[model samples]
Target: MTQGRSIRLFLVDGTPNGLLTAEIMNWTGHVLTGPRSKLSELVQRPECGRTGIYFLVGPDPDNSLRPLVYIGESDDVGTRLKQHNRPEDKGGKDFWEKVCLVTSKDQNLTKAHVKYLESLLIQNAGQVGRCKLINGTAHEYINLPESDRADMAFFMEQIRTVLPVLGLDFLRESFGNKAKAEPSDDAGVDSPRLYMQITKQGIQASAQEYEGEFIVMQGSTTRVDWVAQPGGYGALFAQLCEEGVLSEPEGKVRRFTKDFAFSSPSAAGAIVAGYNVNGRTTWKVDGSGITYGEWQDRQVSAAAAAAAAPE
Candidate 1:
């Protein structure tokens, strides 16, 4: 098991959504986050003038599930942020609404150091595939001493740990890395934790609960087109296709290219079944003929009854 970690978060104006700073216990790096409207105040902070790597985060207008991110670095992040706050015609980046910057508390990052960090973060963000990156061209290489590169890589991991806690998840790695003791293929020893089916059309899928997401695993059989009634499910199917999460390899028969997360089990079911169906009722054990909702309720009731029994 992993050891517990301690982090301190400080709200500058005593508001939950306002400018905030975070630091892990015993870490030399500091994280600062705030809305674009608060950039002036953020720039006023002492560390804002330090060389650092920063992330500009905002929504992707075309897709609600994918965030829009712009990763950058600067010798003086404060000045760069000020420039981005200006009008687009004046060299500003209008797409971003929030900013998160990582700087050392000791103000040790140099220009080359931040550039290296910027490039690494950009590459990782692209591989994660959770967001739409807005960088014009990739910044690929930055020379650094071997020792410093190792230190910076460790620093990057700590930043990754803190970022999602602050609601900036564009830097998160892909879900494939989390799956263990199970391979995505159907012929494997470990099958999906749950199965949802549309038996008539021979449409079925393997899914599992993952980090609060109902993830339909890879190789799950799905429809190539949105064959369901025109409604929310249709919209979702179209979006999934547009995002390339679901694709047809042999034509008219879709396979999940990557694991996809649905807001709820029902949503996951609808996408896999190609219909506006009830997930709790549609998903079941292979031969149990019992609904997921019923199974869950039974387990809950049994646990309560067991707890109530006098020890």
Candidate 2:
């Protein structure tokens, strides 16, 4: 079982959308985030003057479903941010609308430490493939001692945990670290496997629910043509197609090129069926024929019965 963690967040401007700072209890890292509009205020904070790694985040102009990210490190993040805030003609990026910076609260991070972190962050973001990276190439750093590397690795883990709480999930892995697109036999040890089939259309897809995410496994097939109403799933499918998650039409059907994680079962089902669908009722247990909704209800009822029973 996972242990619960306590995180402290302060809204620097007393507004949800304004500058904010986050700290995990007992952790030495400090995270500060704010919108590009708040750059003037953000740069004024002393934390921005320290050695740290920062992320510039925004929507991808071409792919609506994914974000574009730029990972960088600096001895003085405030100055670097200001330079990036300049006009595009002056070598600034126009796509990023928000910034998230990670610095050590203890002031122990140095130029070398941040550079090592930046490289790893860039590499990890690329491996996750949840965002489009604008960085040219990650620079290498091999000077850190083995002990420092171990410490930085722990710091990186904390960043991973806090970022999703702030609604940044590009570093979150959708498919568990296997390079294989198909689900392995041990894939469902922690979660139940579900399947969706449309015999009439020859559509057959497999999925699994894990940690609140619905993952559509690879090799799932779907209709090549869009039969549903415009927008919503149609828009999302187009974006997935653009991102190469789904392959191009090879006749009347297209296939999932990789396992993609969706926020809900309906979202995954919609992409598979090429339209809106009630995923709860459509996705059934791999062999039992019980709907996802039914299986969920059964689990809840079992837990309730156990709770109401003997001490």
Candidate 3:
């Protein structure tokens, strides 16, 4: 079971897409996120001067389905961000659209502390296979004292907790059992829902609605090769293979090595079924014959009725 978190968010510019700061209750770590447009404004803040690990995130032009990430650690995060702000011709990271940095509010983090964090982040983010990492090679981890390692580990925990709230999902690591996202509060945990897809290829899979995506569980078999090669699902399927999300353990058929997330149920079904298909109609609730479309309609109808009910 996952415990609830206490986090406070501040909109520095009072706009949704502008610079933002985040804090976890009783934690020393501070997180900052903002558009690349506000680099100067962000670096001027006090926390940016501290030792920390930072991520440059943006959509991949080649794979619109996934974000591209570049991770780095610096003694003075402010200076490094400015260097990244340099023009593309000057070796700046041109692919970055937004920036996020993790630093300690108490300024107690040291050089060795952040290096370990940076190294672990790179390794795990690659394994998560969510983002397209632009970092060429993983940084080798620096050794830390026993107590220091424990502290850095805790600090890393806080970083993972707050990142998802900032709209970064680079740490969803899945290997054996399938990467399952904690049922987030905003995913309408107010209701419990499940859907099933039965493909003509004898593919039988179950999925649950999570956050805004439908996560097909691991062990779900997918066509070893996409029959088509020219559309969004095909592109996404190929990217997943490249990222190591889907693997072949047995025959020529590919299986989801972990619970994989899709933008919609149809997207999941399309990839699993090896062709284009309507997800809403393809997936159904087990035991009941109702399709996902019908189930969604029922949910909406219930909300309307409850909203219209007199107090």
Candidate 4:
């Protein structure tokens, strides 16, 4: 029989039998011991059936309850409490990490009751500088209707209070901001420079680029007249299909289903390569054998040479 926090020693029917014993210590640890009897024994006991939320507060060497942790709820408070003090389960270290179950007198420990108690603890835990409630049992209770469950609202509030402490800024940011109307003066600037449209039929891509201060058009459409470029330009066409840019078909092959549109030759090349196509080897500059990559390089070199020339 190990001593625990607050011992309760007594005799059974005038025979010196250790009916129950509990040890209570400040920060060291605590335990409770009793004979293995039927659940009826605990039910019949006057001190049994203790129900409610239990707080596991401990000193952080400074002997202050400022950094308490752990909150728990139990229908069978006494049994849960005993489990916390058992030596088998890491000496109750897991229970004390966030919450602990203590003896409660609430016999009819309904789901609502447990939720309400957990919520109260969560709310208070934040104020007391305790860790955030990592447990999900609190939220489970909130799903119940208030009419059916009295503790739903209480738990929600507690959850709200602790959410900030847990550094859940992403959730707060997402829910806090409301979408506003788009601002004016966003005409040409707002237009998508690239478009990848999916349809049920097939994929198509178009590109427009400035060449020597003149706009040149290049693209691939459903028209078979468009010359098929070599290398992996076909891959971009393939990607359009994979990306669902093409319309959904009942039973036809879904390959080459999507369409891509870009304003810059480089952008189109990038889109092709990014989607796993060899743009350099695939697309050709005009009817020449020069690849997209070779064309881009020549353009860059020409620009650099012109810039370095006198002026």
Pick the TM-score winner.
2
Ranking by lDDT: 2, 1, 3, 4
Worst 10 residues of 1 by lDDT: 183-192
- Compared with the true structure, the alpha-carbon lDDT of candidate 3 equals 0.80
Question: Is 1 or 2 the stronger prediction by lDDT?
Answer: 2
Give me the displacement of residue 247 in model 2, in angstroms. Answer: 1.9
Q: Which stretches in model 3 have alpha-carbon errors above 4 Å? A: 173-203, 210-212, 218-258, 273-281, 286-311
Over 4 Å off, model 1: 180-192, 224-231, 248-253, 285-311
**Candidate 3 Cα deviation (angstroms), residue 254:** 7.1
Model 4 ranges with Cα > 4 A deviation = 1-47, 62-65, 88-91, 94-106, 127-140, 148-311
Task: List, residue by residue over 1-311, the lDDT tens digit for candidate 1.
Answer: 35889989999999998999999998899999999989889999987888898999988789988889989898888999999899999999888999999999988888888888888888888877788999855776657999889888888889989999899877765556555434553322222368876666666788766555677888888866777568887887888888788885445468888777777889998888777778887777555757778777887899899999999
- Candidate 3 lDDT, tens digit per residue, 6-98? 899999999999999999999999999999989889999998989999999998887766799999999999999988988889978788989
Q: How many clashes in each structure? A: 0, 0, 2, 36
Winning model by lDDT: 2
Model 3's TM-score against the true structure: 0.76
